[model samples]
Target chain A: MPPDMPTEPIRRRIALTDDGPILVHGPIEVVLTDGKTMISDRAVTALCTCLRSSRYPICDTSHRRRVRNVTARGSGSGMDRGGRGC
Target chain B: MLSSTSPRPVTAPALPAPRGPLSSAVLAALRGISAAPHAAEIPPGAVGQADPYGEDLQLALYCCYELHYRGFAGVSDDLEWDPGLLGLRRQLEQVFLAALGADVAGGTDVAAEIGALLVEPVDAAGVSHHLRHAGQLWQLREYVVQRSLYHLKEADPQAWVIPRLSGPAKVALVSVEHDEYGSGNPDRMHARLFADMMTELGLCAEYGAYLDAAQATALAEVNFMSLCGLHRRLRGGLIGQLVTAELTSSPASDRLVRAMRRLGCGPRAIEFYAEHIEADAVHEQLIRHGVIAPLLAAEPELARDVVFGIQASTLLADRFADLLLSRWAQGRTTLRNPLPELSHRR
Candidate 1:
């Protein structure tokens, strides 16, 4: 394959995302354990190391915390973040 | 609407219908019906009298800002810099800003504001959530029509802040905007993708076609972007608007995707929101660390304005959602002119 063909070494900028996807700046091809390969052409491709994203290998913000604090709530004083009033 | 490259004149859509005196005068000026822009009775000393978010003021301000993006057909390009129009625009902006100033209390806590946006409220039932669960197909169609006004010109508004920014913020903003403009491929541009989605959904995809139907809140949302962009002093507000959009879009977009899927929408229609699902995830990161962080570091004084920007965007968006949900609850059309119900859709 032309991609596998000999070429000069190219530098890659990689950032480790805490409990999230690994940010790699460049076009990348990932070979999965089941022999399936996925290719991304984004300027920066987020490879999901946590494997939590619905769109595998791509961070869908599924890594963000979603704690259900039952005790932290009072008599639901008023509507919070999203607009959900009747 | 413009396909301009370097060293080229641009083209945009024609004028939309005027709701009241404010829009009527501006539209008349654009049509050359009044060569004496100064003579035109367009909110002359009446800016303060107009309701800040009413149909008249919002639509009038929207027309003025449209001159910067895509001037109406047959309108003079030189009109964009007309002093009279700028004077009127300043008046309208002051009225709106005064209202916003009174409404959203100003602060310098950018971190807390963004943190609130990051958390997904479990009790949320915004438009996307409603559409995902119980919204009818016709309601979905209406939502797209209203949204088309902004989506057709996706990244164009924020693009104005480019020259105003410096260092890492500018670089990062441009990088995210690069993706919005379709990463050097006009075919993949978010605007183009949105247009395709509109076509797939059997709606008019042409620029500004839905202007007549868009409500005051919808127009106000776009006007907020233009208001911030045209002024160098309001760059912080523009970034704040951007941060709100990038941070909130991912989850809302995911719900939209689910809505489309539940409604059995075509792949092309789904692609637009699906693209947002992944793209905005990355964009949120870029805005937080790349744009917001660097911008605050470079210019610490902009924090209050940034908060203003965030609150303004949220206020306008909530108002829009309120209009949609309330109207839908009553089984009425949110748009001024209701779309014809297609037999196939029903």
Candidate 2:
């Protein structure tokens, strides 16, 4: 597989199992875990911010990538210095 | 719709149908059929529906303001400077601003206000909240469709303040703007991303396609940006609007990204929100520490205006959110035309 192509053609779909916000935008033909596939022409879009994704931005993969870079980098810091990444 | 990069000038859409006497006269001027404003034939302020967010007033104000953004498709560009139109715009703005001023309580502590904005309500219910939960792909698409109005012209309203700002404050605001404009890559420009999302959703990628379908609630929100952006006097308010947008965007963008994935959207759809989640997180800090703090430090007297800007933006945003949720709760399409019908159009 090319570097850009998924190693295993990871299945992905954008779905809302519950009332959560999750939207994804990229190449078309991505499939979700719930068996739904979003086929499109133009590329790029906004996905739901909510964590409950089935194929996220495409069905129901339910993937959650918390921007833990903030928490991970700033653990145990109070609000005053929270943004400083202590 | 005009892109500075393109030689082919971006023309505005045609004036919409008149909803009432106010809109009728305003639309006439936009169409070049009238030479003057209806100063003598003012709609008795009392006659207007009491809703400050009324469709007729907002639509009237929106058409007047659109002249500044993208003038009507066939309308002469010079109409952008017509005194008649300007007069009418002032009348509408006076009424609209007065209502907003009354609704949003004034405050002196700018930093405290910024602190409060950073704190999202635990029980917040918005389109993002809806999408994060059981929001359908169609519903998610619908939300983007409405947002296209502002995002399509992202950063333009604030750009008006470039000349109005100076020193570190001006420098800071432009730095953030440069990113919003794709940091030298047009493809990465936020508006382009928004347009990309619209096309991906199978909606028309043309600018202003949704203007007709957009209600007063949505139109007014953007108009407020223009109101602040265009007036040099309102530069403080412009920053307030920018600060408010940047401050809240991080968390909202996070929720939106998740909403997309849950609905099985593609990467193209995800990129716009993904960019915001990270970009705005930084922007939140930059706006607070970089832009607002330094700006106020330079022009201490502008503090009151800054507060006004924040309060007014919140007032407009709350109204916009309420309209969308209420319409959705009623099981009706929030757009003037239903999304289901839109998909079938193509």
Candidate 3:
């Protein structure tokens, strides 16, 4: 490592909201436990908390509703992820 | 900013041909040899008589606003602040504001408004819904062309309000603006991505290329942004417009990505909406809690303006969607002129 380069892991601010995605400031790539990596190049990115998102790691606004109707037909994915669209 | 540099020269688009008497008058002034037209007062109430949402007024107003964004080819850039053009623009804005103010039911309940926006309408009949279900490639192309009027210059109108804001509200708005500007990567800029999609779809990607084909409804959406963002009094209105866009963009963008994939479009075509789905999702949250909350907390009085912004934008969006859907229902083109037929190449 270069002498000027800090040998410490930089502490970053990640805001955890009461409900909805956990907000991380600046671009980040999350390596999930399942070994799938999700990279978001945005200045800020949202990680869905509800587990209903078809986009998985990143929030696709699936968590907006109070309770997404269980039997709703379209998830905007047009791809049925098993039982229900929502 | 993107590390790699491009060789091609970036230039402003040419002035569009006029649609009517009012637009013709604007075009004449812009194309003339003089930097600013000699101050000649027109007949009283001449502007008020023009339809608020008509093509003539919309296009005329668009030309004035365009001077601020990217001056038309061969037109004087100095005209952006020219008194004669500014005077004409003010008259146009008054007619538009009066009409919109009368049409929408105004309120200061920003929380309730944002809550309503969060819910996706089950029985929605919007253009995005139609596209997601069963819209043709040509129709989609035409839709993209009309939208390019604004998307080609995305984030620019809203940038005007930055100077008008301060404290946490200012910081929050700038945070979102930074993302919209591609978080320091110029190549990833939303406008560039939109242009990439246009090229992939075999449509002209040049800015203002489709201005002539854009109807009154399309121009009204962007005009509203310019109108609100330019006025310090309408800062709340600008935030309202931004809120509506960020809140609604994700779902609609998801549908658009599906539509593009369903039509077997190329990667570039699909990439634009795909990026929006993720980007706008973050933006939605930032706009609601970051920008709006802090703004209203500082100045509790701007609530009515905020409501007016949301309601006016929503009405305009519905009008735009209705126009496209109705035209497509009749098996007709939504544009004033049909798009140039796509050239086939491997």
Candidate 4:
């Protein structure tokens, strides 16, 4: 390491929620699997973890559970596959 | 050289016409025509007998709170602190607060309350849902007008609690507020965005332009924010209101964005809700983890008040939504003054 450079690496903290997004302290540049990059300059950014968000790479709160009544018959699968139908 | 047009002119809103005796008296006091009623002058039974959520009480309270934000065009600025007005405001607040306290099932389980807010009912009948699925452009326009009462001055009411909070909670809350204020960019401010959307929708974008048209239900919703915000003791409740707004806004905003697009609305009209889709998604996390956690840790006693704020605000929101939905169901205009028909702009 060069003498002019700091000896310690600066650490960035991110928070994980069980039912929601991963909150990363931003301005962060997120690169997707297809090699496309998106940047969020917000003070904090919520990266979608559920893959259900309409605004992919940013959570639009699509992770929230949709409650269907017991008698309601359809695809009983819990996750909404139609991308929130907004 | 840049042209020197002012970005936003500082025109105070016009005074709305009085709804009833209480609002008439309050307006008279604001106009400096008659002295505000002394405590004894108001019959003790008058405020008690008035429906807590009725036009008279809600309008009176709204006028009083308006003094703090931007005093009406002709109203004297000094009257904001007038003892008589304040006294009447206090009586009005007592009745309003008592009604809310009686209505809500009070508790201290902030986690449970938040958890419940997170679940979306599959068959939700909220205003946004109606707008997205089955609403017409006129109905959507009316929604904007009623909401303009709050959206035109967004993020202002909750700002009252900033001074009342300490440590990390305050820091987190301010960060969220900074975003609401457009992160130092005036044009991107949420209030500005809302005004732009209103203009795009062919509605008047001026602050308080629709006050006369807005009903008591709409005024009461904004009044509740001002009520909690102005009181230092109600800081926890204010936070509760803030969190509730942040938590629920994202998905609803998404729905509204889709509604606008489906109705052939332009980008300027959809921008406000479109921005909220991501902005509130981030804000929800900040408020829950960054603000609420440390706030409760520092003052656990506030949990009950926070819960009260959440439930009461939710109740008010539901009432507002119900009013709009039911009125729309009858194919009637929801505003006190029906909006003028929009010429074919789409």
Candidate 5:
């Protein structure tokens, strides 16, 4: 152990939004179902819950509601809509 | 610390050409060629008569605010605190503020306002939308030039609000700013990334390089940030502005990344927006939950100003978008000066 290292175990916090990503205090590494790992070193990382993100496991704000006012495909649409299982 | 061999040195940009009388006077004052107008010396209706959102006033206000940032090359650093210039700035701010106050439908329901910003209507005709659908390379280049004015100094205006906040809000905001500053890596700094994008697009990447070409609408969008950030009383408004930017940037950035790819721009040009797509997604969450929630809990009275900030910045942004879309529709350059041909150096 380093001379300045803390003696206690550190507890990590996770925040949940009403309609957004799961916020995790980070410098964290996540192992995907295929055994590949993704990491984020940001102070807080937003983990995608909606499964709509183009960058899977990371929030790309794809969870936000889209108001379908017109038939045209607008810029407000997320990067990858092919994730729709329908 | 930056070494002496740094590729880009911190050189101040040259003074931009003045657009009209007010800008001419402000520039002259900065150059020490003449005195800036003192509040008492100005004619009764002179300042009020200048179009609040027009070329003259916006450019004049922009020049005044520049003094607080990387001031013009030949302008004296001491002049940043010159009593005369400060007085002129105050007057300019009033005109701009009054216009914003008159234009935006002010409110205090921060949650409701943010909620509205979250939902994107499919009929949206914003610049991002146009670029995503039918934009040409020239239009994209023009858009970059106008946007370079702010992106070159990305996250700076909002830094002014740090000292004005406390507790969790301050910490949260700083965390977002830290990411913007590139998470302790100078090369990844958003400003540097924007400059890199400019270079890749065959545009001048120097700070304030496009000032002479940018339109009043572009200047107004940046000036609104400076206005709110500079005034401690408008701290809530500053947060509101910051939140609005974070909330909308992700999807817009995703569109921009696609636009760049569609235009066959290289990876460096696409990197800035591509990074924003994910970065702003994280920022949106931090701002809404970590920052706004705590700050508003402590200073609930600032809700009105926060809403004002959001609405005013949105209005300015819409005006900028309208200008670009209208100009591009007519096959016109949105900038004051047209951009040069893209250099084909791969």
Candidate 6:
């Protein structure tokens, strides 16, 4: 075990593993097979917050829609003000 | 919890200690080699009894009903179809459903009933209200554990009516079901989300873990689900139950979400309620405008049963709420026994 290894890795059975960055959320610590390690906040996605692009889990056009939605809802409001569905 | 391929299909834990003679007979029959032939014998005045919420009778009926859901751990799953047990279950149902029929006044207007359901109770002194205010995490966990009996396989009880329904009603119900089933995304399934919350809260995620400890009120509530679900004739009742649930769920769910966050629970623990806050709000509208509207529009006769379903479900819910709140008022745990003494921090 590496000295800096995460003590508690987020555990979920892999349902699908494609050629894409795996998104981990909520108190996660990832340990790659080659001993690389990473820790994350509760909401972090793999290199992309916007759910866009053909290569999902990676940013594409989806991020733009998300950015606008965030703005429409007002940044940092935490409440989706846009009444898309009531 | 066993996977499909597993050789050992998980069984329900053994019947809890019997509450009365009715439960005793029911449990004995469930555990015995051959069911006692007197399965049809009704406790004197079982039907007309003023307090139809008798723990003994209710628990017995619940046990008989549980066979249809998850059979007890040591009990044979085949008992689910045992004729004697079925006969017993039917008798119990007749008594219980008859009581509900008599008590819940028949409503010719289903729309009025559905509309009435959408109206949230003000100053509703229930678990959700408690949770939204001073409810501690342990209390919330206990409540969820009690709720596990239902949420673990939500939408299943109502699923019985899918085939019974046609046209718009069926499509709308299925639409709601699709979401409940996670829209082909297993990770997003509501039941899965609930289990995740259980795990996050350090409760046993195994289905039915607390069956032995769940009081008769809790058991009766889920048993009502099974009663309405399993009977083809009770499809309207089931839909009524479903409507009541979806309609009332959103605000309660919002309160639960706030409760989880106030207690400083993490995202996984809060996600179940958070998801329901939106999902059930949409489901409420769908059930009202989509399902019930078309359903009663087609078969207007079902309105009576629909009323029965709503009233029966509400009665059971009130009983459950009383059990919990009364227990809490006495500074006691609502479970049959308090969970193993683990001091829950925060």
Per-model TM against the reference: 0.90, 0.76, 0.90, 0.92, 0.93, 0.74
Model 6: how far residue B35 lies from native, Å: 3.2
- Top lDDT model: 4
Model 3 stretches astray by more than 4 angstroms: A1-10, A66-86, B3-7, B33-40, B342-346
Q: List each candidate's DockQ score.
A: 0.20, 0.03, 0.19, 0.23, 0.25, 0.02
TM-score for candidate 2, please give it.
0.76
Q: Considering the true interface contacts (CA pairs under 8 Å between chains A and B), give the fraction that model 4 also has.
A: 0.26
Badly placed stretches (over 4 Å) of model 4 are: A1-10, A69-86, B1-6, B341-346
Query: What's the lDDT of the predicted structure labeled candidate 2?
Result: 0.67
In model 5, the clashing pairs are none
DockQ of 4: 0.23
Q: What share of the true interface contacts does each candidate keep?
A: 0.11, 0.00, 0.18, 0.26, 0.28, 0.00
Model 2 alpha-carbon drift over 4 Å, by segment? A1-86, B1-9, B41-51, B340-346
Local distance difference test scores for all models: 0.80, 0.67, 0.80, 0.84, 0.83, 0.66
Q: Give me the displacement of residue B291 in model 3, in angstroms.
A: 0.4
Query: Which candidate should be chosen as best, given DockQ against the real structure?
Result: 5
lDDT of 2 at B87: 77
Candidate 1 chain B weakest ten by summed lDDT = B1-10
The superposed Cα distance between candidate 3 and the true structure at residue B214, in angstroms, equals: 0.6
lDDT agreement of model 5 with the native: 0.83
Give residue A47's lDDT in candidate 5 (0 to 100): 92
In the range B1-346, model 4's lDDT, one tens digit per residue, is 2223357788999999998878888998988888876656666688889899999999999999999999899889999999999999999999999999998888898988887777766766778888889889988998889889898889999899899999999999999999888777777788988999999988999999999999998898889899999999999999888877887788788888999899999999999999999999888888998899999999999999899888887787778888888988998888898776663222
Chain A, candidate 2, TM-score of 0.25
Per-residue lDDT of candidate 5, residues B1-346 (tens digit): 3523376788898998888777887888888888765767555676889999999889989999998999999888988888887898899899999998998878788887787778866667778878888888888888888888899999999999999999999999999999999887788888888888999988999999889999999899889899888999989889888887888888888888888888899999998998888888888888988899998899899889889888887777777877888888888778888676652112
Q: Indicate whether candidate 1 or candidate 6 has the larger DockQ.
A: 1
> lDDT per residue, candidate 2, B1-346, as tens digits?
2445653246566667776777777787777677656555555663244355777777777787777787678888787777777777787788888888887767667876665665545455665666677676666666777777788888888888998888887776776787788766677788888877777777766678777778787787788889998889888888887877776676666677888888777888888887776556545545666678888888888887888887777676666677666766776677776764465221
True contacts kept of 5: 0.28
